[model samples]
Target: DHHLNPCYVCNSTGHNCRALPRMRPRIPDDVSPTEITGNGLSETEPPVLEEEMEEPIGVEDTDFVLYVSAVETERCRRGLTVAYASHCQQESALDRPVAGHANFCPGELSTKYRDLPSVLSTVKHEMLHALGFSVSLFAFYRDDNGEPLTERRPDTGNPPLDEELQIHKWSSRVVKNITRKNWMIRGGFMERTFHMIVTPRVVKEVRNHFNCSTLEGAELEDQGGDGTALTHWEKRVFENEAMTGTHTQNSVFSRISFAMM
Candidate 1:
């Protein structure tokens, strides 16, 4: 899901995906004319009209009304918001030369990205980030005394048996203090502390899934672009894991990623 573009909702801040109702575009009545070409030829079978869908049953009202479009191609489809983008056509829309027409190629994904499953996985990955898989929730995971949100790790060290490690996990309670040991301290004793930015709950989920005690910071140790650095799963540790800054080919959302989302 290595989409360079940030989340359309929340503007790549990556919090509140599933909880956030998608913004229905304030569609303006004045639409630019749509140019059609040979591709608009009538199909052998006429298109199936949309069935009147019932409002989603038993879920929160936020669930969108998905108008199932019976199209043979992805180009005619809409994004997650389910907004209908009716393109208006003015006079002589067909007279324009198809050679220089850019609208014919209007797509965000092409080439290897055109694989439907891969595209869907990438959408899942982005949606996870939008729902706060890794974001500013770090502040919520610290106590007033500036300790991590977890209870004391029993003896402040390892347990005798591997089975005993489960006791070391986080308690149901959550607290945080941003005044000290926050994402700002990037060097010295606090260098690794950057990892705390993703709430300990998520870190705990990640650690438990991998059976690893040590969890660390942003995927890129070096500086990164707007979409990288603080906003991803550790790439080195979770290669091909969907939440990492750079999406891998054929990546699937890992269990830890799903839980955090």
Candidate 2:
């Protein structure tokens, strides 16, 4: 059986623990008002009826919750996917996720390979994706001061469209372009370009990791199409990092990943 525990209950730090705030669903503006009681009471009635008071909805006092489940899938058997995760709900006030879901494939959970380091790392990696590491959530990110990093529509509280009315999702504050050179077989040298996350903490950590003071930021994965591109670290640069697109033996949760968070 799968046993789950609240992180706040298991945390030893008590008040020092920085946790995600619980999100409350917003009520629709078009909701009709509650009907008054004893509306048709005669004027001759001796006693007047009091309107019943409605109790306010209470929200749980805890961090975000992640629901995990195991299932069988063809992708798992074909070695195409081991697990997948996504945020299911977001808090309107902060624009951050309050709940997420992760699905694990039973085929990849065989007794023989379940205990492997790579397998364990894959589980943690998927959990990270559920939390906030997603391209879809980038536009909702906020800065240290609780302000949105990307401009949003005041009415819908969502990212606004570009001049051409195209969906503009990525936050310019998070992603930037950097140019590099690649030696090609046919061409002597070619200018290769890709996007990178230039958040302050990410830039500091990556620059220190490579001991390059002039470096702009850490590179993001440009390959692997929609599933892998922009959402993960570049495989060639971060071969064994847990946030990379492909899992490798002895995968490590690097400090750079934490800095990105």
Candidate 3:
């Protein structure tokens, strides 16, 4: 039998056509009545709403409450502590860290991001980074004599399948538990690593490790922004080839920002 998942936008109304899904605003707890217009001009202050702090749930609005309840239960079961942040406004969405170990902001623990699936995926993604896997974590590896071992190129000489498998094993449990009612996570951590960073080494590593290409090359297109950084045309040629049949070329900004975040 075929089961239907709610459409990303309009919650599968079958008639209500909207450009994007209706997202709940994660307004700051200390909001005043300053109205910010579409043109980004401020007018009057926003009225303060008196409500208890809420938990972060998945972004799909209809399922938000349910997802929150499940998340609370899971957190309880895992003995994970949660906190909230009220300062996360839409305009500053990119500035906040979704959740973290000790310094979690108010509402952050409970604030659903743009969409439920994407936010949950991001949670898992960030958790992996926290557990030590991303570029930040690569600095942790040491040789028997206390020298950095991960600084050298991984043995793509024989393909780093074993290392990739190890990373998958480490992240699988935290990723497996969240039920989205529809969304399911796929792809290994290696794939996520490739998408999250832009570097020649990461590009080559991903290509040799997973036999795939990513948007890292596209970021090379923006050269004049920073005065000192320079990109060579050889990599630019590869970037163009990687994105031959894809959409617009400005996506590198998005990919680079993702890693930086």
Candidate 4:
């Protein structure tokens, strides 16, 4: 199962795949203000226009765009996999993701699976990853007011990881650590550690779901190595939820998943 995890492919390169060059607005050539204003015309007079200015080049009309493609592969033919996706490019200023790519396996596109809830859910799940619901993109997240969740490097604009193996980056407002103790039937107690998304909306939903007012935040998957860890909801805590690392027969797009988004 670890070998089949998709994040290995999604984050293969260590960075969001080579970022596309940023599009900068092209400024128009200089034009004299007086020449367009009819040579010292009075305020009461209407200004004569010499030419109409065209809209600036390279101005984007949309905030984000995702490019999807289907590719047939032997692996998909043999496995139960659906698709894989990743953010390909991101805006430099706020490190906001502006472009991504999703690759659906053509081999798995059968008529039987068409409009099926499981396949549709898988599509939505991969799209969410393409749209920044990823560990690689976590460092680039922004607050409601457009501030970076994690501090970024001035030169590279990427968040520095705390530990290469375990902790990547931490934003107290977005994610936090929690300790849990579970009593074993045979012996004493087993201690477990978890990272949680402590954002207000997510915390509210989590608390309401578990009926525990003191719950910190929603739990994130801490297993499955780099492929499944940190980027998804913990399967044990949120079984059958669409955002969990592994797909399930009865996965649902729960409110907690939406709130985390």
The best candidate by lDDT is: 2
Compare candidates 2 and 3 on lDDT and give the better one. Answer: 2
Alpha-carbon runs more than 4 Å astray in model 2: 1-59, 74-79, 161-168, 181-187
Candidate 1 wrongly placed segments (more than 4 Å):
1-60, 63-108, 111-114, 134-194, 197-200, 214-223
Cα lDDT over the full model 3: 0.29
Give me the candidate number with maximum TM-score: 2
Q: Assess candidate 3 and give its TM-score to the true structure.
A: 0.21
Tell me how far the alpha carbon of residue 44 in candidate 3 is from the true structure, in angstroms, after superposition: 48
lDDT of each: 0.38, 0.71, 0.29, 0.71
RMSD to the hidden true structure, all candidates: 18.5, 13.2, 22.6, 14.0
For each candidate, what TM-score against the reference?
Answer: 0.37, 0.70, 0.21, 0.68
Model 2 is weakest, by summed lDDT over 10 consecutive residues, at 1-10
Clash count, one per candidate: 2, 0, 20, 0
Per-residue lDDT of candidate 2, residues 95-176 (tens digit): 7777788888876664665567667787899888888888777777778888888887665567864444233476768888
In TM-score terms, candidate 2 sits at 0.70
Identify the superior model by TM-score, candidate 3 or candidate 4: 4
Q: Candidate 4 local accuracy as lDDT?
A: 0.71
* lDDT, residue 173, candidate 1: 43
Against the true structure, candidate 4 reaches a TM-score of: 0.68
Inter-residue clash pairs, candidate 2: none
